[model samples]
Target: MNDFTFLLPTKFVFGRGVTDRVGAELAAAGYRHALVIYGQGSVIRTGTLDRVLATLDAEGIEHTELGGVRPNPEVGLVREGVALARECGADLVLAVGGGSVIDTAKAVAVGVPYEGDVWDLFAKRAKIVAEGKLPVTCVLTIPAAGSESSASCVISNDELKLKRGLSSELHRPVVAFMDPELAFTLPAYQIAAGVTDMIAHIMERYFSSVGPVPVTDNIACGIIHALVEEAPRALADPRDYDAQANIMWASTLAHNDIAGVGRNAVAGGRAGGWECHGLEHELSAHHTGITHGAGLAVVFPAWMRYVWRSAPERFLSFGRSVFGIEPVDAEADGVDVTPEEAVADAVTATIDELQAFFVSMGMPRTLGELGVTADDIPALLETLEQNKGAVFGDLQPLTMDDARAIYESCL
Candidate 1:
């Protein structure tokens, strides 16, 4: 294993009706006023909003409400949230929806204390230098993105057709309430998309070009196996609290820097290659209608197909560990098949199995199926190049031409 540091300070309260403690927790933490951020009418319609409001009222905590945070989240809404948080003098920013809402709240938390434009932080024009930020917390209603306990937050700019993410310890939530029951009412498609996103999170770290960090690899593989085992059960019955709990916790563990701790540094300084995420972000950023996880479902396997040749051993390990696909014997089941050929076959089968899993979850298998075409490639590439330079990924640094080829292969 490589040298690494792990510091996760988020106080996670998980179980049924754990959200009921949000008010008392905030009050005990001495947060006098909070800005409650949420997405559409789901929170309100499901009565989650009312429950939260009543809790706050009981604890005598003042709060301001900000709704309409869209999926993939927008910089405009984040700015508006920051403004409202400042106007209300909110000491805490409480997100009451999924990843989008939590990410927005994190952005707002950072923006509320900084004097410059919030976009400057994400665009790399400025840094978060404040010693203190508005404390952010969440009541997770969706189990994707793992933003509730992660340092990273992704926000989109509609005008720029760009989605960008920034990671800073300041953005990590101070508290996160996870109640699987909250996700029981989620649609099957959303659950599947969340599952795919969480799996991609682990895969991104697992495919790192770093040394053989057996511990990290095993943990990543175990998380993938657990998700593979539990996602279907949760999808079949959203009320299956055990399955939902497993997936929910796996989502958090996948992206909380735990899986990629020792694997962040490779010889090329590429760290955990997020090539697929870089590509998928552009797709979602430009299209706006494409779900983040659904786009990932389409892009990740295509990315694997395009780049697996660069790191066959890593791919083979993934095949054997995550998918439980053992390599064929060199001479047993076939006529003069080399060990290399056997490994290659195993890797191909693993990728095919992953694609099939995504399909079984009702995810599109191609960019075309996700509503992207050859004509969209130029625009997508332009966005990617403009936002993230010419190349992406650490496992195999992908240049513009490489990205084009990956998109073409997907088509």
Candidate 2:
């Protein structure tokens, strides 16, 4: 068993219209001026931003709008926001959208204290360990990236197709205002992608060395159950509040370090192994890109096929418990499904179902479908190949060969 320790301090405020409480939460944090950070035009189209601004104004909070945070948020933007916050004397940050918004906000908060370019944090995070950051709060719109509660942010340096997560104990949001109703209008594909992301979170942690920690196992199982159970209901009817709430909580809980907490647990707890993340980051860097959720859809199954040999009974247990695919039947003298195949099939089925769900929801299902060409592949692979040797041993150790094979299979 690998040894470990854990600490998660993000305060979660959840419910329908719970986002309206951002003003109160920030007041409790003693912040008077803040910067409103969020993603593209959708937040405006949906009026989530308008409502958030109205609520903040009602609470008498002064703020500046730093709009135009993009998908695969750039380090340059984070640095720009830091400059904005400094010029305006903004003391706190309110991230009013999905994972990218929160991730971008976290990057800005950290950048405020740094003297150099923020890209330093993403490319080589060894410098500033932690400094005084403007406390951040989230009005999460997308549930896919658990970044609302996670302390890590994957920033892409636009000049290069390079992407890496800048992590520090300093980056977790002080508050995550997760209102399920806010997620009601989310497109069907986003809903599928969000649930897919949560399932990946659980699976990444579940593969930890099969220890006898009942709590960890139970938590992993519960997250898987909540995700698999609510995905269809949410997909069938986008505005189901109960299904939305169940999933919203599942997505947050998936990465809050509660599910896979135990000393020497199989999956790395303090820092979970993100084998698929390495593959998906480059996939997103290429083309208009697949949703992080959809990239995960391909990366995960292809990855399970790559790692099944490392842990057989664990994968078998996953198939049986999560997918309800039993390895053997009492009446069948016939050959039973092997754990490896069952787990792989279950994972692939999960991905394919998610892909079908993605198509139904107006999201891309394949890299080719996303317009990522063969020209993009070589540059993308080289981005991670150069870095894998440097960032080993979080969830699993990955060799360059392992990285290449996974990418080729994903293609």
Q: Which candidate leads in TM-score?
A: 1
Residue 243 alpha-carbon offset, candidate 1, angstroms: 0.7
What's the TM-score of every candidate structure?
0.97, 0.89
Tens-digit lDDT string for candidate 1 (201-257): 988888888867888888888998888899889989989999999999998998897
Model 1 lDDT vs. the true structure?
A: 0.89
**Which residue runs of candidate 2 sit more than 4 Å off their true CA positions?**
1-3, 209-212, 263-271, 329-366, 373-375, 390-396
What Cα-based lDDT does every candidate model obtain? 0.89, 0.74
Give the alpha carbon lDDT tens digit for every residue of 108-200 in model 2.
888888887878767674465465678888898888878888757777776776777776767789888898888888888788888887877
User: What TM-score would candidate 2 get against the native?
Assistant: 0.89
Error of 1 at 1 (Å): 2.1
Note the residue pairs that clash in candidate 2: 208-266, 208-267, 209-266, 273-395
Give the clashing pairs for model 1.
none
After superposing all C-alphas onto the true structure, candidate 1 shows an RMSD in angstroms of 1.6
